[model samples]
Target: MSIEAGKPAGLRERKKLETRIALGWAAIRLTVERGFDAVRVEDIAAEAGVSPRTFNNYFSSKAEAVAARHLDRARMIAEELRARPASEPLWEAVANAVMARFGLTQETRGAGTSDQQWITGLRLMMTEPALQGEFMKAGALAEFELAAAVAERTGTDVERDLYPRLVAGAVWAAITVVTDHWLHADPPVAIVPLLRDALHQLAAGLPVP
Candidate 1:
């Protein structure tokens, strides 16, 4: 197909992604404001400026909507990792890929640096009982994507090799633990430094202090 022919398809895909992201953010905001149990799919759709039927086309449940943001970000990370310089070490590439867009913005980063209300909302959303299972599913999806990227980068078979999956798991764990610490730190800390340190330690074999 020619460039002109592909333009409409690209635009359509972008619009769908934007809609999905809007719905997910709406779900998170509503859940934070009214508690997870009180929020409904219709409310999320309305908040996102879409209809309930449209929301249903994107996500089966409110929890899935909320988790979609994480899944999307993870996929982006995998893509970024794939694009990093070939000369860079795998850990460095992975870290840079993650730090490239993962929560660098004021709207999504942290309570201390960004909007407090949104951070508080995110904290509430993370702890919701109904959302836990969805988050796990999101994590699994994220890990799978990362593993595939790692396998490609290292020229390993993702299906048969253990290295890619292990690296992916470690990276995911670092992301999870560091983000949790940043979220709950007594004196709030910047997420970027914490994430960088976590990756550094992992790359350095977690040497004794």
Candidate 2:
């Protein structure tokens, strides 16, 4: 059934989303504190205050749980971008939509200088050799959302268009680079500005070859 305008999410949908988020955070926290190989699916389920069976409904493996956050955020960003005024510039709209989901702004990072929690989470996800497949798995999960948003911006069908795929790939490549640089920075540089600037550069054709 279609939800009417202004209708809040139904209880079941809310609960399912919350459970997925809780499980993802639990997986991140556990793996960060104890190392990836040390964590297990049962432990993640327990930390999220759910049973193994409940956890299984959301994710197939520990890797998938760890990677789920990006997928969730990606979907949110896609929706947000879709809602932006069509008159807005493509790169500006996409960047703002993404930062909105993270509670970030062009002038501020969400967490200020205290970056340990999330930076640690991202670093673990990016650096853990065992989780490399999971890292790519996360990126893959976000790919469709990016492609669809790009297609929408270009007034084209994602499934049939090359521009959408090309633009989406470029955006992801920029994001990957920014994320890596942010994780490796000695003082934990603010991500929001970096992300905004990266998008701006892309918007400008990245002329500094």
What TM-score would each prediction reach against the true structure? 0.88, 0.85
Per residue, candidate 1 scores C-alpha lDDT tens digits across 52-147 of 999999999999998888788888788888889899999999989998958736453323443556557668878887799999999999899989
* Model 2 bad stretches (over 4 Å): 1-8, 103-121
Worst 10 residues of 2 by lDDT: 104-113
Q: Which is the leading candidate under TM-score?
A: 1
Question: What lDDT would each prediction earn against the true structure?
Answer: 0.83, 0.77
For model 1, the local distance difference test gives 0.83
Query: Any residue pairs clashing in model 1, and if so which?
Result: none
Compared with the true structure, what per-residue lDDT tens digits does model 2 show for residues 1-209?
A: 11222357898878888898889878876776677888999999998999999999988899888877767777777777777888998888887887787532323223332457667766766678757887787787687777887797779999988888887788778778887888889887987788888888888999886
TM-score (C-alpha) between model 1 and the true structure: 0.88
Best by lDDT: 1
lDDT assessment of candidate 2: 0.77
Residue 10, candidate 2: Cα error in Å is 2.1
